[model samples]
Target: MLIFYYSKGSSALAAHILLEEAGANYEARHVALAQQEHMDPGYLAVNPKGRIPALETRDGFLSENPAILTYIAQTHPEAGMLPDTPYEAARVHAFNAYLSSTVHVAFAHFQKGARWTDDQAAIETMRAKVPVNLAEAAKLIEDHYFKGPWVMGDRYTIADPYLFLLHRWMEKAGTEFAPFEKLAAHVAAMRERSAVLRALEAHEIS
Candidate 1:
């Protein structure tokens, strides 16, 4: 069984949802970020980076959503979490990479600005830019990346959960999604999934 450590409402939700979708035997261990338990000595021992969503596998621990999500998908091939074709699989990877590197990073600047700077003014500036940054990301995903219905057209892969997580973040940041009709519809469809509901309930997130 895998030991999954995560904080509620964080990007960890993506991996949590995927685990449910795969019907994997894993323990969801909550590392409360509000209490700063993630930075505690015991938690750090599991993930030295002190980041949420660390997975303890037979080999060792793995961090990062992209890596963990892929691991789960590959391990449980029967779940069909990843695409079969190499080119299509690479496309999924590319989309996930953008969410991790660009979209997630932009969202982080809103809540984790202190990680980048000590100046209060600079932190506020970063926070202020979050709406614009996320709006741009939403547009890019809508126009270029999103393939509709599911992230990769009819099939629901690991990318769907990641996109769902991002959509959640955008809502929290007070960014409007009215302009992106497809994204709005996508979030609605995701909400109907049993896996998403299970993950949300487990995470205590509405």
Candidate 2:
């Protein structure tokens, strides 16, 4: 069985959802961030970066959502976790990359501004900018990426769960994600999935 290490509702949620969607026999282990359990020596041994959503395979553990997600996609092609064509496949990667590198960064700035700066004023500025910056990112996703139904349009790919993670955080941050009608619809549709429901229960996300 695959062992998945994750926080309640972090980036790990996406992979957790996909694992359920693929009907894989996997164990979901929660790394309590509130207790700083992720930084514990044992967990660090699992992932030196001390990050959540680390998956242990027979050979070793895999960190990073992009890598974990791709592994799940390739391992279960019949689940349709990925797009059909090469170009669309590239687009899927692009979408995930943007969510991780760009969207996630925006959120991190809102919550963990100290990671970027120590100056109290600067950190506050970064935190204060989250709404506008996140809104802009949402606009980019709304106007360009989402094409009705899914991130890749009409088909549910890995990017759906990935985007779902972002939207949840955005809403939690008081972004009022409903203004982006399409994104709101996308998030609503994704929330309706049994896989997502199961993953949420397994993860026990608040």
Candidate 3:
């Protein structure tokens, strides 16, 4: 049994959506970030990093979106969540890596600036730049990473959910979508999926 530790409105949504998409038998444990449950002793023992979306497998706990996502896809091969080819699969990883490393980091500047610096003014500056940075990130994805209909073109892979998470973050951050038409269309398309709707409903997200 896979016990997934996740919180609402976090990047964990990506993995949560993938779990539903793959139709995995898992227990969803909500770690209340607002209540600081993540920092609690028990939760800390489960994940020293205190991060959401940690997977409890028979082997052990797996942290981080990319690793957990890959695990889900690999374990449930019939789901075809990943491409069989090496280069194509690497492309999927590359897109997800960009989201995790670049886009998510840009949003973190606004959401968790204190993690970066102690200066209040610097934190405020970082926060102020979030909208612009996110917008640019969206443009980068549209111009380079994103392929029409899905992140990896025709077949919907694990990267789609991560891309959808980016869209959700952009929407919540009030980042204008008028510029990235393909991304806007992709988000709309993702919303139509039964698994996507299930994940959104599970998270109590609109």
lDDT: which candidate is best? 1
lDDT of all predictions: 0.93, 0.87, 0.90
Instruction: Give the Å error, residue 189, model 3.
Output: 0.8
TM-score of 3: 0.97
Whole-structure CA lDDT of model 1: 0.93
lDDT of 3 at 100: 88
The CA lDDT at 118 in model 1 is 100
Model 2, residue 150: displacement in angstroms? 0.9
Error of 2 at 145 (Å): 0.9
lDDT of 1 by residue, 73-132 (tens): 999999999999999999999999999999999999989999999999999999999989
What candidate 3 gets wrong by more than 4 Å, as runs, is none
For candidate 3, write residues 17-117 as lDDT tens digits: 99999999999999999999999999998899988879999999999899999999999999999999999999999888888888888888877999999
lDDT of model 3, residue 151: 86
Candidate 3 lDDT (Cα, 0 to 1): 0.90
Better of 1 and 2 by TM-score: 1
For residues 1-206, write the lDDT of model 2, one tens digit per residue: 89999888677889999999898878888899989999999999999998888999877999989889888888888898888799999999999999888998899887889888899999998888888888899999999989888888778888888888867777766786878999888878978999999989877764
Answer with 2 or 3, whichever has the higher lDDT. Answer: 3
How much does candidate 2 score in TM-score? 0.96
Q: Which clashing pairs does model 1 show? A: none
